[model samples]
Target: MRRGIGLAAVLVIGCGGGSEPGGIVPLSEEPAYAVVLSDYTSTAIAMVRADGTAVDERWVTSGTETPGLVAALSGDVAIPSAGLGDGTLWLLDRFRTDVLTRIEVPSGEVLGQVRTHDAGEGESGWSSNPHDVALIADDLAWISRFEPNLDPAAPELERGNDLYAIDPSTMTRRGMRIGLSQYDVEVAGADGTSATAFARPSSIVRLGDVLVVGLARLTVAFDGAGPGAIAEVTIATGETRLIELEGLHDCARVVPAGERAIVGCAGFGDMAGKRATAGIAVVELVDGHVEITRTLRFGDDEQLPVASQGVVHVDADRVLAFEWGAFDPATPDRLFEIDLATGSAVEIASSAGPFELGSPLFDGAEDLALVPDASRGLRRFVRGEDGTWSEMDAIELATDLALPVRHIARL
Candidate 1:
């Protein structure tokens, strides 16, 4: 049975919609579209009003609630149990602020039931980790699964080649594995600890006619991943081509800029266990093959970064990316805008560390990008009239409403 709370039916509980302003939808209004928060440490999926304040502590679900990742489909949210290895997809209605359906994914958890927050602990059996869900249409989608038992010392554990086609209506795998190509990565040991590890997939993007996938298999615990590969998947035929990249680790943030895919790559120093600088891989797909047209590296002066996430395409050539190094107070995170034509990357904004950087969300008009900083609050980057991206005012999240949100899952 599907479980959900109706939005319009909550007026009596003071949880109903709020008043209007300027004949415009008030920021206080029962969230025209609420911001869903998945705090893994807190073990809950909470919500903040549309204005980025106003916390609803009770608006959470029960279970072994580790909010790994989420995808916004139209107005609904798709949250998979990547961290939990649960074979379920929680489909929540953003407007109603409730889960309307629970769809299963390939190799989903055997505990097939709607889970509650206070549910007792149980021995959920072994299963493949469901990494991400990419919807191609209303009832069809592609889900990437991770192979289990990734041994850090064993370099062979880094090879990941799992992608599946599924029908949402039935929660079933539609065909055989859409094979992923393997890339060899060499990891070096810094001290007694071996840096060698397995390469795994990180992010996925859809280009003009192909789906771009990021694979970084050799990831040593906490030290970060080894050199990665970006694969181009044909949507119509489910055919995939694995294009290996050099000096590139995790391209968590990949965006489509016109004819090419702007991939933010971390350099070789990451494999040595030190916080290293990052580079940009400017790639274009031709005849279903991945080609690296050019690679842009930061000068020696810009050496305090590792990898990037929440990469967004601003205009025709300008793309925004957030850089991550170590995340301590001494190490500040960076935001950059890359010029595709010149391969020039300019630092746009920097944030004090000890805080987590949430995924980036762009306004419907694509004029503004919003990222939540768990330690401070929320930060906004706007597309300037001059074609450059400029920092806008950032508001701190209400410390009392919810725990420092790990990531603002969806806007």
Candidate 2:
């Protein structure tokens, strides 16, 4: 069940590794633009024109420093609001950002803000760490939690998951606590001695009726206890299945093509270990069973690890992947066009700086938006008719969200 596409051997493109002496192509393309919550101290959600111009920037004046952590662009609308999964749009007090502000999506009216009594131990905290949000149809919001509330020495608190069934029309929080569990890890690869590891809830994808979940795996020594296998939980039935692998870090949303899912595997540790595996791994979905298909690596140095952050299926034969800059700062953050047809990949374009790319989003309609790092914000790039690349000029949008802008979804 393992398809090995082998390697095309692309030379590792390091940061600041440029070919033309003139420097990055001057951005000329201008497209539609919009910014969400731009008035705040930091910018979070934004909409850009097909030509690279930012349309508008709206700064959700949530008093919290990191408002865009779970923000999204409402369906078919340019406004960036915090609502998804069951139609629950999130509203924070403009005066007090940490307060749970609720707002209805349909009419843009404010509902009562959520209030909480201190639960003592792991209950009340200074900050709210809402990891990922999934839109269930348009009624329920499935919000994941990864609270880094513990100091380095203190034992990590019992982390739980929340599923909010918000009334789309009223924007009220419903079905708040769905499930809770200990922090989990993902498996990327395994050898006889030790397996590579990843941490919990790195990425989540909704597939078919069930949500295919991917977490970071902590590849520990086989001799002792380590991360459990990667698992999937059924939202409807609450059934969980472990799709075991050896090492894993982050995973992009499932690409719906035929029945296969293309998962990007980064190297071993936080680039801490001496050895690592950098490539793209594939999983097949059949009869509700998850199976590993094939792993494709870019370029020759298999050791040069490709930390794929995002992937999208363009066609049966072609797919797009984002390669975060590895090891060297000069390594260009690369956009790889993978050809399953030849088991080969090509570097279509790259930002020479270490633009630590967040997950990539393809409107599929035309434009592409990529967030670099959790704190640095986002930069919009557009492809032109001539096939050359450039930045958008008209619409100026901010990418950094103070807190890391880890994920982005097209609503």
What are the candidates' C-alpha RMSDs?
9.5, 13.5
C-alpha TM-scores of all predictions: 0.64, 0.60
lDDT of 2 by residue, 79-191 (tens): 21222332223432222122233433322223333321122454454333344455564445454432332323322332332222343333334544443234343333444
Residue 309 miss distance in model 2 (angstroms)? 1.9
Off by over 4 Å in 1: 1-38, 43-127, 137-139, 147-161, 173-175, 184-197, 219-225, 258-260, 268-277, 299-307, 325-329, 343-346, 364-366, 387-401, 408-411
Q: Which structure among the candidates has the greatest lDDT?
A: 1
Worst 10 residues of 1 by lDDT: 110-119
Q: Candidate 2, which segments miss by more than 4 Å at Cα?
A: 1-41, 49-52, 59-122, 125-128, 137-139, 148-158, 161-199, 218-229, 250-261, 270-275, 297-307, 326-330, 367-395, 398-408
Relative to the unseen true structure, what is the C-alpha lDDT of residue 104 in candidate 2, on a scale of 0 to 100? 30
lDDT of 1 by residue, 281-361 (tens): 767776756688876555332442333565655666666666663633366667776665665667767766733675555
Per-residue error for 299 in candidate 1, Å, reads: 5.6
TM-score of 1: 0.64
lDDT of 1: 0.47
Candidate 2: what lDDT? 0.41
